[model samples]
Target: VNYILIDKFQEKFGSAIQNLSESSVISLELNGINISRFGKLCWLQVSTKETVYLFDILTLGYEAFDFGLRRILENEAILKVVHDCRFLSDCLYHQYKTSLANVFDTQIADVIVRKEEAGGKWPDKLRLLPECLSHHLGLPAAAFQKYSVSRQPLEQASATVWTMRPSHSALLHLAARHMPELLALRTVLLDKLMVPFTIHVGHSLDAYR
Candidate 1:
């Protein structure tokens, strides 16, 4: 994963946007405190098949979205894969006035697939990302435990952990590592949606928008 800060943003933005534009699909994950209109968005991770770029949102501020990121997000032609898009959509629309389009939300998709597997009965509750990863992608508990350990320090520190300047390396790694799994989970869920019995459930995934 390449960590792009404000100092190198201008030099990298052009090529980054170009690569993103050419890709048919990309994976995204946002890290922050609270992550709503009222909260802070610290990092924006974008992953294509070839690379993962972690943009420092806290340092770049509005400039991060203003340059070209916002346009790519709003582009309906390219599909953006995310775990759960509610808070992400809320944050982007309210804070940046950016409407997320053509999203393939894995959380919603997971619920749909699970419901079908359970004989059309809805799940008792929404599954978290780690749970979804384990259920669909067979991610081991040890792996989840490792990630949890990496995230625990910052989370325990305070809500302001995301706001700290010169973010901890563990935090950055946590942010970057999520993209590949997220993308992989999307592929697995999509394949499950392809069965004839689940065709309607697949169509229902668009309800996320």
Candidate 2:
């Protein structure tokens, strides 16, 4: 299988009507944009003819997956957008989980919290941030804990995770390597809005629509 990896790219198009003018490869007719942020929407589309997927680093979710996997799952030409990217990634993780297969900072934070759960070189600014709220309210890391945890640089983990299941392992490492080490633990959604919800709460990602 061709393991395509794209980094720092977007798949945005103004509208189906507008994109139609570009190339048959480019179009705006999408199945639907499930969850989105920052003015970008994440959509999932499929065709019986083929399946397409895109691994652009900027946007690596359903849109790219649908487009890149087109040949495997469908034959119908895909209609994709290319605005900011990542719009779909935010939601796709929640929607597809395993099918979409991705990880991010929120996820790692949640994991470590269950263990250390708090305070390790976090930034003062993040302390009040809505996303990191829960983190602070909860017990800081582990006081009398026996296990060991270390907060490091994200760049450092990026190189290591690749050797062991790059995708999942890398993201796991990334979460631990957070910049401030800990987000202020602002909001409860840190778990809801992050990988935990996507990995545990969401439905079978294999059945992603």
Candidate 3:
């Protein structure tokens, strides 16, 4: 998988995303560092059918929220697929006051397709990302563990890690692996869901309609 770092974001953003047309679909994976204490988002990983783009938000800071990036996320024509996008949603709104326009959160779709229990409670088995990926796509448990190892260090690392180039390369590799599996998982989940899943009126994602 190809990777793009923040130092090159401005120069490469145009060319990297130029192929994203009106009908293109992109899978997204977002990771943040020190969320409760500082709420700093560290990485933004996006993947099309052919490529992966890793944007280091912590490195870019407020510039990461520039109009071009905003336009892509806000674009109604390009479908953004995220796993459980709660943290990503919170960061987007907190940083940019932007509500995602066209999004499909796979966790919400799974809940809807699995159906409510007799008492109208959602079943919990298929909720988490690793579980869904493993069950639906047969990804090994070790893969998730390795991803966690590669990511947890970056997530919990000191703020200086973002400024250091060598510290982030492996993290980018792990982050890049996420979107491809997500696309595969989405296909399997959609097949199981067998219908379109709709987001309710509230900003929070839920399984309704």
Candidate 4:
């Protein structure tokens, strides 16, 4: 099946994908817009829960983030296996596969990602994670949120920026699923090398509840 990726803000802005004359080649114009993977990632980290809840209420007369519910599940079968809102909402509404299969994220606590990039300079530590939150919220290198972003209304802008941003992998993969370089990279970084990498995993709903 030909998968037509409908990328908007992050990439593939407006109208036609030209340059196929007797050849099945998709060539972008000289000024082709690359999707804002950074921005989308920011949004996902921020907007997803709200967006997914909107999806749940779709039958109650609300608009969903376009095509979001499809991302939640390719089919309903996956839904029956899990009941957590984060798992279901992230997978279907936002296209995340959160199986934690053969994963060591639960096991690692000592590893740390030192964020030394000059732009968002903060001493590298495990606590202030996922970059956007660390920098925007002025998280100390070793600081935890200390409070939830959603709990406080004042930090909502910061929340919105980081949460909705999509990863570069998703955008690139959408362009070409078989893109060897990225797949290899993801396999290594995401599926391998035992992470807690540079990102912090938040508490589970059970813990919070």
Please name the candidate that would achieve the greatest TM-score relative to the true structure: 1
For each candidate, what is the lDDT?
Answer: 0.82, 0.31, 0.69, 0.25
Estimate the lDDT of model 4.
0.25
RMSD, each candidate, Å?
5.9, 17.1, 7.2, 17.0
Task: Indicate whether candidate 2 or candidate 3 has the larger lDDT.
Answer: 3
Off by over 4 Å in 4: 1-157, 160-184, 189-209
lDDT of 1: 0.82
Instruction: Return the TM-score for candidate 4, rounded to 2 decimals.
Output: 0.20
* Models ranked on lDDT: 1, 3, 2, 4
What is the per-residue lDDT of model 3 for residues 117-200, given as tens digits with 9 covering 90 to 100?
A: 224567856566777777678878897887555555766664335445554466667778778778787787777665333333
Relative to the unseen true structure, what is the C-alpha lDDT of residue 163 in candidate 1, on a scale of 0 to 100? 82
Candidate 2: C-alpha RMSD after superposition: 17.1
Error of 3 at 55 (Å): 1.1
What ranges in model 2 sit over 4 Å off? 1-64, 67-124, 127-137, 143-151, 166-209
Q: What would the per-residue lDDT of candidate 2 be over residues 43-101, giving only the tens digit for each residue? A: 22311112222233234445543444333222234323221224344444344431222
Model 4, span 112-146: residue lDDT tens: 12232233355444431223233333445443333
Candidate 2, position 92, lDDT: 40
User: lDDT per residue, candidate 1, 1-209, as tens digits?
Assistant: 55444324676777887888888899987878877898888888889877888888888778767888899999999899998899899999999889999999999999898887898899999987888888889989886775566565644455577787777787677778768788889999988877755677777887786
Question: How many clashing pairs per prediction, in order?
Answer: 0, 42, 0, 29
